[model samples]
Target: MATLFDEPQKFPLAERLRPQTLAQYQGQAHLVGKNGVISKLLQSDKVPSMILWGPPGVGKTTLARLIGNHVKTPFFTLSAINSGVKEVRQVIEKAKTRAGSILFIDEIHRFNKAQQDALLGAVETGLITLIGATTENPSFEVISALQSRCQIYILQPLSPETLVEMLENAQKQDEWLKKLNIKLKETEALLNLSGGDARRLLNLFELVVSAFPANQDPLVITNEWVLSTAQQKTVRYDKTGEQHYDIVSAFIKSIRGSDPNAAVYWLARMIEGGEDPKFIARRLVISASEDIGNANPTALVIATNCFQAVTMVGYPEAEIILAQATTYLAASAKSNASYMSIKKAKELVRKKGDLPIPLHLRNAPTQLMREQGYGKGYQYAHDYPHNFSPQEYLPEAIAHTTLYDPGQNARENELRKRLKNLWQDKYGY
Candidate 1:
C-alpha cells in the first residue's frame, strides 16, 4: 500500500534506524524499561545532571537526545575534543536564557580539569543540566568535585540477542530495507565483527546489503559475505578515543585475571590501532608490580626488560616481545599485597597528619642533635645475634599499628614467617 516515494530516503542504516522515542529504543532494558530508573525519571519534571558511562555505539548520545525530546526542553551538544573553555562558556551563557536546558558533552572523559571546572558553576546553580557521555571510567577521568555533583549511570554493551532484534526491527521498520528480499543465512559473522556494537551491526549489515545486484530477488546474507565486505573496509580503531581506553582496560584486566589468550588479543587490538608501544609497555610494568608483586619479583624484571626491548625494537617486532611479556605475566601467580600496603600506609599518613618520628629512629648528624636524644637509643642490629633486633620503627603516637598484610603466596608466606619471628605479637602476622 506504501508508495515508492514513501520509502526511507538515502541515509546510513544506523542513522535511519535511530530510535526516536524511548518505546522505540532497543536494549538497555534495565535503564529504559517500563519500571526502569530512567523511565521513572522521565515521568518526573526535574531531570538531574548525569554521566552516561559505556562503550561506543551503546546509545549514550541517543538517550540524551531522547530525554530532551521527552522533556520538550532546549538541547545542546558539544564534543570535548574540539570544544575549549571559551566555547563551553558560550554554551553556558546561552543556556542561562533557556531555563532547564540540557548540555550533552560527548567523550567527556577527554575534557581536562580546567575544561570540566568551567561547567561546575552552571551545573551547581541549576542553570544547565549536564549530561556527560564517556567510555572511560569516570573516577579516573572526571574530577572528584565535578563527579560529586552528577549521578553516574553505566550502560552495557548490546547482547547478541538485542543486536539481532535491532537488525530485525530495522528491516521491518525501514521501508527501503523492507522492500529488499534480504535473508540472513548466518548471524555469527555479523555479531562477532560488531563486538556488541549496535551501530556497527547496522552499518556492516547495510554495506553487505548494498553489494547485491539491484534486481536480485532473494539476497542471502552469509558469514562469508559479511567477513569479505567488512574486510574491504578498513575498521579504524582510534587510539586516542573511547575505544583506546576500553581496549587497554580489557588488556590490563585480562592480564590481572590470568587470561593470556584475552590479554594477547587485546594487545593485538591496541597494536593494530596504532597505540604507542611505550604506553603498552608501561602498563605491563605497573601490572607487574601491582598485580604480580612479591609473588613473582622476577615478573617486574621481565616486564621492565620487555619495555626496554620494545623501545629498542618498536612495532612489528615489539608486538612479539609484548606477547611474550603478557603471556608470562598472565601465567604468573598474582598478588596485590604491596599495592594494598601502600594504599593503607598513605591513608594512615593522611589520618595521623605527620606524627613525630621516635627519637631513636631519627638521624643524628651532629653532636648537638645527639645531645637532644636523637638516635640515642636506636638499636644496632649488626651488634645483635642473627643480625636482627625488635625495635619500634613507627612514631610514638601509632607505634603498634600494622600496615602490610602479606598476601597468601609463596614469596609473601616466607615474608610473613620472617616478620612474625622478628616482631612477635607486635604485628598479628
Candidate 2:
C-alpha cells in the first residue's frame, strides 16, 4: 500500500495517532477515566476554564485537543511562542460571539505576565473556556489572578510500561513499520534514550525503522544503533529546557554520590553553557543542607556563606566561591537523615491538619494566658545542669513524634551520644 518513494513526514506518528476522543488518549487515566473530574464535567457538559501542567510528551496538548473535541463547543488554539497579546485579544473577541468556546494556549508559561493578564477577563467572564498548557510550574510563571481563576491539573510523564505499549502498538498498527519487518531487539535502549517522552520514543522508533537497509529481513533495532543515532551534541544546555534539569540533577547526584570529578565536570558543563552561577550556588546551598546535612554541620554554614558571597560578587568571581563550595560538599561526609525527618514531619502535620500546640511550650506573654496553664510545666534548660533540660517540644498528642533522627556520622555521633544521655527512653541513637 505504501511506496518506498514516499517523502519522510514531519509529524507522522503524533498526527496519525492523535486521539480524536478521550478514549483514544493513552496515560492520564486519573482525569479521563470513569470517575475522573474531566470525565464527570464532560458528562454534565460543564466545561470549566483550567490549566494543564506536565513534562514533555505527556499528552498535555493532546488532552486539551480531546477535551475541545468532546465538549461540543467552538475551539481555537494558539502557541505562546509566536503569538502576542494582540492575537489573544482577537481570539477573545471571536469567543465573545461564539457561546461555549474553548481557547487553548500551548506553552502558556512563555507568555509574560501582561500577556497572560489579557486572558484573565475572557476567562473570568466565561467568554472563553481557557485551556492552558505549561511545562513550567504555574505558581512561578503565571499571574496570581489568572492562576486563581483556572483549575490546574498536572499530567504525569508516561510510564515506561505505557511508552513500551505505545511502541508495540505502533509496530502492530503502522503499515510502514510492519512492512519493514521491524523487530525491537531491545527496548532498554529506546526507553533510556527517550527519557520517558512518548513523542521522542515514537520519533526514534520511526528513525530506527527508516534507517534499516532495504532487503534486510526482520530488521533488528539494537542498543548500539540507538546509542549512535541518538548521540546528538546538545545545543548549549538551556536551563529552561529539560536538559537543564537533567544536567543539574547529574551535578547534584555526583556531589551527593561523592564523585567530585564527575561533579566538577557537570558543573563546568552548566557554567560553560551559560547557567546562572547564583542558580548553581543555590543548588549547592540546598545540597549542603539536604545531602551533607548533620554529617558536616559546617557544610550548611559554608554553603550559606558561599551563596551570600556569590550573590554579592556576581559571576566569573562568584564562580570561584561556587567551585569552593562544590568541592567541599563533594568531599564531605553525606547524610539525608535531617532532610527526610523534616519531610516526614511536615507530611504528617499537613495530613493531620493543624494540631494544637503543647501547653507548656506556648508563650504566656499575657496574664490571661498564664491563667490557661500556658508555660506551667515548661523547664528552663539554661537553669539546669549541663544547660540541658529534657522536655517535650511537640504536642502531647504527638509527643512520640520522633523527628530529626540524627545519622551515625562523626558529627551526628556526638549529637547522638549527648541526646541519649539527656533523653534515654527516646532518640534510640
Best by TM-score: 2
In terms of lDDT, the poorest run of 10 residues in model 2 is 1-10
RMSD in Å for all candidates: 8.8, 4.4
Model 1 residue 368 CA deviation (Å) reads: 42
Q: Which ten residues in a row have the lowest lDDT in candidate 1?
A: 1-10
**Which candidate has the highest lDDT of all?**
1
Q: State candidate 1's TM-score.
A: 0.69
Predicted candidate 1 versus true structure: per-residue lDDT over 322-404, tens digit per residue: 99999999999999989998999999999989999899989999999999999988999999998988888888888788888
What TM-scores do the predictions have?
0.69, 0.79
Error of 2 at 13 (Å): 2.4
Give the distance in Å from residue 310's predicted Cα in candidate 1 to where it truly belongs: 14
Question: For candidate 2, lDDT tens digit of each residue in 157-202?
Answer: 7899999899888877776666667777888888877777787688
